[model samples]
Target: MIDNSVRTLFLLKHSPYPPMGGAPLRNWQNIKAMMQLGEVAVFSVSSYKSPRSREYPPGVSLWKDYSTGDILKERSLIRKISDRLWWMRLYGYPEADQFYGDRVAQELQRLLVEFAPNIVVFEEIWLYRYLKIIKPYGCCLIYDAHNIEKSLRRDISVSEHKPPFVSSLSGIKTAIIEGYLVQQVDQIWVCSQQEAHLLQKLYRQIPPTHIVANGVNIADYHSDRISHSLPTDGLEPNHFTAIFTATFSYYPNSVAAQILIGQIYPQLRKFYPNCRLILAGHSPTPYMKESAQEDSGIIVTGKASDIRPYLTAASVVIVPLLKGGGTRLKILEAFAAHRPVVSTTKGAEGLNVRDGEHLLIRDKVEDIVAGVCQLWSDSSLGRKLAESAYKLVQQEYSSTAVRQQVEQAVLQLLPSDFRF
Candidate 1:
């Protein structure tokens, strides 16, 4: 039987199930937490046209939107051209997702009437256009600000100077959209205190914003010992291994890998000649694969079914990300596995971790080299940092810890007399 009390309708940009780390993991945890408050239903867009998988929270409902192919087949050339022109004029770039079609809007409208939720929560700001449609229902609106979208785009532009014009325009478009949404929503949920402060400063008129930190399901990653794997090359078992993991589809992760292979690894190898590097994640670029072929010690494991094995096999985990926003789930995963980590300042942004205490934070080439060398050389230090990091993750970044904060934030958005 469905719970009649405190129904919430979620609008998501992507499905949370079969969590692939990053935004999906965060969304899955948030939705899981929302179920504790009351019944929840999710409406999301599929990035591709794959067979739908049913792996959501128990008792919660899910409705998926179509991929681009489904829409383009029905869309007329003139209409498409007109949309492109309109997008260019208004947002200074052609953003296809913003104005997809009436089909999605109609579907959302139908679901809204049927579900009749007391609270309508959106995962990201991209879905704000549908906000107006939910207004007549009198449900409280909540915006889960994953990251300040404008700031993220601006940061990318500053870090990687490619497509500067599009990035600048996209940043402006995001700012305009975010500014409007912040005022309209009843409350906003940010991932970190840094994000909360940034949003408040950027939009002073912003409504009550709550800090709901990103977290991991600790049980999924805890491993007692590093999994043993035979050395593929002439390298011995004693070779120091450092692993960097992330979906390479994201631009920042790819850049981070390049930096790791090109700069950080070289420096570290000078101090420890037997040091090996592992790039593990989905969709490894051609360059990454080619680089791996060039160096026998550099191993690229593209799209592993179980990242835990790859993570477990490593002596140290490194995040050399030069750009990106929000707290990193990868770092939290490493901590959950009780693995020592070395990361850049930007890589550790928004995380409740301290430099030299829980994880090593180093930005410069020399510092990163030194950090990795120290972690690999000093077994005692590695164990100490890993233990402290695991405790921190359990206490602060565990699902239970984050869910309570989420629940409180959602409760505050409801009427004082509202009951579940």
Candidate 2:
């Protein structure tokens, strides 16, 4: 019973067509779930040049797509700085003005007038800048909190060894912006209960919050359907392989990749000489690329179009993240692919799974290496963990589960008399 009359619009910071990384994947999944509710339109503004695809996800009407790079190229340096200064004075942060220019605002206003959406969903906190434009439209507003930005910024600063004063200021500014954004929205959608609780603790007079957990497409990552072909070189079918996949541009993932190369893999090779390490994802750092070149056993696959091949070739998936906010979608992908995972406590945050029951939870370098080696020596242990994890994904973190959550949360915001 699809309702054609219920128009819902999504405001995104990036296009989710191909969904290469976590944020885009979540956006894509959220868009798909919203399609079940009514007519859906997306307006995305990308800060960088992303690879565009002709084949978009079915059932989404792309109202407008803009690239910040293209928009700002012709603008004068003085003008850009002026805009930033003006935005900082008004909003306490210049990110909104930095990402969206006058042209973008004009076009967005035109979309609002024509589309006349019944509901407006802001994909992430960055889009909070457009709230002023959206409020007058009289549409129900939903803010999707991808992460508690303040906490995430603080974590990143600490991990990157940023100065204490700089980190504190950044955190404070983010808290002020995010705190205001949450209070303005009709309802807030968070990735986990932990995030919902954190929001409640941080902000006062916030709207109703719902936990719509991050999910993976079960069919896409099913063990039976994944290909055996390795996507990168330096690995064979017989080689014991460990894989870590993420958008390496993200500060946390980049840090984890450094730890894997600098600390984990070297120790791992001592235990298993045939061991191979693969870092598969987009925007890997130059350090990673150089290390891959220097070490024959390490393969860094940049911007994988499809990750299933790498996952299929992996003996175990590793997530040694020291700092992160949301649940790891990469872990769920590995679970759906029927691969054993070894992660730190921070890496497995927000997920409802025991350390020894679903996957090995190890924080120390020696412990992680030992866990991987134990799995290597005893195939039964890996299979047992993988089986349990696969079942967990099916029950709690699959696309179907997420869609149901989204439907329930969104429906609660609609008027009692409204029907689909």
Candidate 3:
């Protein structure tokens, strides 16, 4: 029995499940949160995860693509050619995912025709190829610009080993297509004002955008206690403890680690001789694994199935990101877990965080050393910063507050007052 009083929202994304990457994680959580507001019909490309693993909320209906099994596999020749053609649209050229058409396109067509949702929410512009089929329905379109897609690619190309000309070409082409895509959607949602403003600054004519910073589930994070697996190697007596949340898989995280381990950690050790830097995340790359094995004061846990132990064990959390976009979920987790943080301007790039009040921020290594030492030497200051951080998370980034903003946005998109 369908409820005529409830509005229907079609939420679509490039992936069906969460926990694989940052964007998908935020999108999945937002979808679950949105369901609490109204009935939702989700359409996504499931080529990345097993369909059985996808958890769809009770009131949210779902539609997915079965065209491609897993995006990590090899494809047929013609299919590969088609993917290459599609990839050039936003990415500006060929890449792995480009060699295959996201199954979301086919499934989106099916969903729009059958379900006819009142509002259609897209997780990323990469799924624009499917818009041609659903646009005629005239439903409100909410485009969640995960990042200024082109700006992210431009930053990524800097660290890439590709030829200079190739990088430039890709950057130019991506900018053009993404600029056009920005104009097509009715409204946009982003993880942070930094990201939302970046898109607005880039296109200069983007639709109304909102900053929906990622929220932490304080209860879920507190459920687990912090523990350490590092053998009490003689270096364990460090007075200053710092932890970084990241995986070697992402360029920004890897680049931050390169600097933190290669540069900042070394500098901090001089001031606090026993300073211990803990790096924990999923999939430690080959380079990361080798670096971890080195006799340096850095302790690297390649892939911790649980990061709560690492977060809990630390006196301070550092988000020394050198590049990239979106809100830093790691910083929020650190704050909610009651750990003080020291981040570069880019590390604390988004959200309504206040420097020194919520978390400390420094750009230069000298400043980073000073910030860490200042917090490390004074237990009262460290405890005060930790308390302030937890309060900041509670005040603004709470799920309740964020959900209010999301519900308001969704309600505005609805054609009339309706309930689910």
Candidate number with greatest lDDT: 2
Give the deviation of candidate 2 from the true structure as CA RMSD.
Answer: 2.3
lDDT order of candidates, best first? 2, 1, 3
- In candidate 2, list every pair of residues with a backbone clash: none
lDDT string, candidate 3, 166-249, tens digits: 888777877766776677777788887667767777889878777776887676566343344433443354557888888566
Model 1 residue runs over 4 Å out of place are: 1-4, 49-59, 86-93, 96-99, 161-164, 224-239
Kindly list the per-residue Cα lDDT of model 1 for residues 270-370, writing each as its tens digit: 88887889888877889899999999778898766567777776889999888878558889989998889999999999888898789999998778888
**Ten-residue segment with the worst summed lDDT in candidate 2?**
86-95
Per-residue lDDT of candidate 2, residues 1-420 (tens digit)? 743366789998877687888888888889888888787888888877555554565788755888878667756787667765653454556555556666787889999988888889897787777888889989999999888887898788877777787677667777777877888899999998988888888785789899899998888875567564545455568447999999887889999999999999999989888788999999999999999999888899998888889988888999999996754898999999989999999999999889888999999989999998988888999999999999999999999999999989877998765665
Better of 2 and 3 by TM-score: 2
Would you give me the overall lDDT of model 3?
Answer: 0.70
Which residue pairs clash in candidate 1?
none
lDDT of 1 at 26: 85
Candidate 3: clashing pairs of residues: 83-98, 226-309, 238-274
Q: TM-score for model 2?
A: 0.94
TM-score of 1: 0.90
